[model samples]
Target: MTASPSAARGLAARLADGPVICAEGYLFELERRGYLQAGAFVPEVVLEHPERVTALHEEFVHAGSDVVEAFTYYTHREKLRVIGAVDLLEPLNREALALASRVAADTGTLLAGNICNTNVYDPADPASADRARAMFTEQVGWAAEAGVDYVIGETFGFLGEALVALEVVREAGLPAVITMNLHEAPRTREGTELPEAMRRLADAGASVVGLNCGRGPATMLPLLAELVDAVPVPVAALPVPYRTDAAHPHFQALVDEAYPGLPSGRPFPTALDPFTCNRYEIADFARAATDAGAHYLGLCCGAAPHHVRAMAEALGRTPPASRYSEDMSRHVYFGSDPTLARLNLEYGRTL
Candidate 1:
């Protein structure tokens, strides 16, 4: 059976002319606004202040984001169960879709249904896999009903979860993009090498497939190069803004995990110290990723509107009018400073 026009109008066509700029760092932005608690995360903000969510979406669009992603990360049933707010699963997802759609309508940005990690997709565990599939199925259905322009599965650490998300979106007859959160060793947390894993996601019918969120551009460049060589589809590159290497990658490396011990009661985004990329570094990565064949250029955790605006400008695309200029010199990191890079220390020669 043929799919409807809405379902068939995939991301491929929208991005055929050039890379589509997208960004979804709402959780980080909300935490900065003091809208989220330690354990509650983003969903709490969605329930209490949907207006804030809508406002951020608008902000991103104004900053040159072509897509406004629904804030569905951490709104899953299992995640809500951890905070004793399991009853809010449907409401949270529905509200996020509503707010994102509203912003898209107001700003003329595309609405993308965003799904992320499950923290329980173990390939070794069948029941866990089944549950994840069910979760993706339900969320994809909701996104389709809400009329998202496309659906994106991002920040996944395990290949199993990413694949399931891709499969579910494909089955739902929607345009889908799946991006894994891979760091270190050229492999996923599940130990699957990314080249093979990316191929699997593409072959499994992801309209676009690649990596995002585990590490910053410094580390993701090599992985994205490998992905461009492996996949036939358009690639996505949405690394976090902070510093990273394979050794200490993942934005959570800055955070103390709630698992092996007492809950820190620490807010969602700790260690957000500005040891991060300025707009120039982000733009450098965007250009390299584009040259390396990434067609979807964007930012992940720790990203702000300035970063998006820089990326849009770097691609030679006109950024949104809400911001006039990039002002790269404002950040020493983005500025032309040989001293900050410390060449003398590396080579032991001032000259």
Candidate 2:
């Protein structure tokens, strides 16, 4: 299942040029579109109306993402099995890839086949490991056959499972981008420190590795600095768009404790999500990420196309025409950066 030499060369040439905008947050976007359920997370939208999925890819491409990731986050076979739809995994994944491929090629973007935390990985159990291998192998087989530019394995919580994903993707002959879902502690739930995790993933053959899915940019900056210094390879980040200030660096903790409402573990709780951030927050985060040497920057859950536009502008790049184009007239309200007012000439300074 190795990639053809020509394909390898193409990928290498793209990387050599520079970093790319790899926007994600598909599950959130689809849910917002009313195509997928929150608790179920079936991704049946791909099978029922693939045009919806294609339209999503088109949005990211328009938002200036150089990589149109296939929206197959929860499309894994076992996730489908939960709703008595195990039979749909192959078609779901393949069709998702097909739509992404068309969008990528048509828009001059790279197709990134997507995989995620299967939640079946167990470090101490051999049978659990076997199930994980089966899951990754099958998905990689499909992605490589579809000629994806590379595969992004993200939101991974367990180090053992993350390693298995990297191994499977590399064995299949496609480059791998692996990102773990990190909390304030900068360790996997399984207790592996992020620096150690980065070194291990790099040694284990992950082409690009970093953090994603949890915590906002304000909280991620410290962890990202350590990551960029630890790994020689490029780093990618797609953090959620929540306000995870220093007091509450963990989004789960905020939701679990019910920041303003009663604590509920319900997925996609609206009250729990009332602490949403604005475009300026992502712009500030992008500046810190670029300074920290993170090349692959993006948003994860709760992200919309406007956030992507802010990211592009913050990075000094012209975003491709998007439905919600970046507004030039939006003046900065306030930020950590020093500002001066020139209205009354009492204390005049440049904006």
Candidate 1 Cα misplacement greater than 4 A, ranges: 1-10, 254-268, 321-323, 326-351
Per-model TM against the reference: 0.85, 0.87
In the order shown, what is each candidate's alpha-carbon RMSD? 7.1, 5.4
Per-residue CA lDDT of candidate 2, range 48-156, in tens?
Answer: 8888888888887787777788888878877887899888889988888888878877777777888888878877888987898899888888998988889999988
Best by TM-score: 2
Clashes of each: 0, 0
State the lDDT at 302 in candidate 2: 83
Q: How accurate is candidate 1 locally (lDDT)?
A: 0.79
- Report the Cα lDDT for residue 294, model 2: 88
